[model samples]
Target: MAATKKARQPAELEMIGGKSKRQRIWEVIRAQRDGLTCYALSRRSGVDDCTTKTYMQALERGGFIEQSNETVRIGDEKQYRLIKDNGLEAPRLTKDGQPVTQGRSQEQMWRTMRILGSDFNYQELAGLASTSEVTVSPAAARDYLKHLAHAGYVTVVAKGKGRGAGGVPNRYRFNLGRYTGPRPPMVQRTKSIYDPNVGKVVWQEEVSDDDL
Candidate 1:
């Protein structure tokens, strides 16, 4: 056991600034969605108990993971599933028998919101979605928050500062405990050009604009 501990130390030392540690601990908790105690998390992540506890607490505070008296789980304590949508190259079955990849951006976001098990701050939402901070721009985030407020899926615990006071700080909380709605539509756009002199129009189809 001592030899094994020694061998894992180098790997543990590799997790500086706690980023890798967060990801590693998250992965371990994800692997066992049924939930794992801190000891179990330490064993699986190959991280020390203290490091695991510290990182786990941070994740919990960020709404990335959850902790009870002893057991640790992904995302919320009651939901026990991470509400995130990134790195989904394909579909897989979740513990609840739902397809991990539900398709469509709104569905993805909805699934993510549910997995998050509660409302989240914009930064938390973006990080869990593996999206850029700007990807969930203030406008888009506001739209979702408004919808959530109306649908009872969530409530605005605090109104957003409106991106004026340094930035928006809209905080939210989940009330529905789940997401259910029709998938959002996907639209494709094309541009057209016209020749005024000839009174003719070009559909701009079947040719790459770069070619012109």
Candidate 2:
């Protein structure tokens, strides 16, 4: 019989209280406002290099994070922002049939509702928001619409009207207006792919993925 090497003892990935260490680490990493080094994360989480490195590797594989050199960044980072689009309808009115404004935090959402008159869709709302200097990610816009619909601030009319329809693309009409506060400045990122072998960031106007 061939001698099979005994499998290495599995390490504990989750802690006792409730959430696993990986989940906790993910939360902490997600809370970081800017790029974080793996060393910093290890120290902050009080996890040893072996555990931290293993968790990070697992996270990257799960698509929960992105890595560049020594820094790690969260994926779907845009979910933290608010979005606006046309598929939104105005908020519901009062007994008197007047616009009902809700809490301040819902302001941006309310604005979205108002802008999305009859049959107003995400594309139009996104265009309006982009032009208005309050840029929003397409992902954010979809989340906001669904939130409004769930809160009864708006109602979904068309379940799926476009090809991109899935969780969103459900048409909505507002039931009331709300405020979320002054729009935060849009984050403008310009990714410059680098070819360290060539010692420079690639700037070709057009290049196929194979070219890289």
TM-score of each: 0.31, 0.30
Q: For model 1, how does the per-residue alpha-carbon lDDT over 32-65 read when each residue is reduced to its tens digit? A: 7555566778888887888766655544554554
- In order, candidate lDDTs are 0.50, 0.45
The numbered model that scores best in lDDT is 1
Stretches of candidate 2 above 4 Å error? 1-109, 161-168, 177-212
- Show the lowest summed lDDT stretch of 10 residues, model 2: 77-86
lDDT by residue for model 2 (163-202), tens: 6545455665655443222321111122222222223322
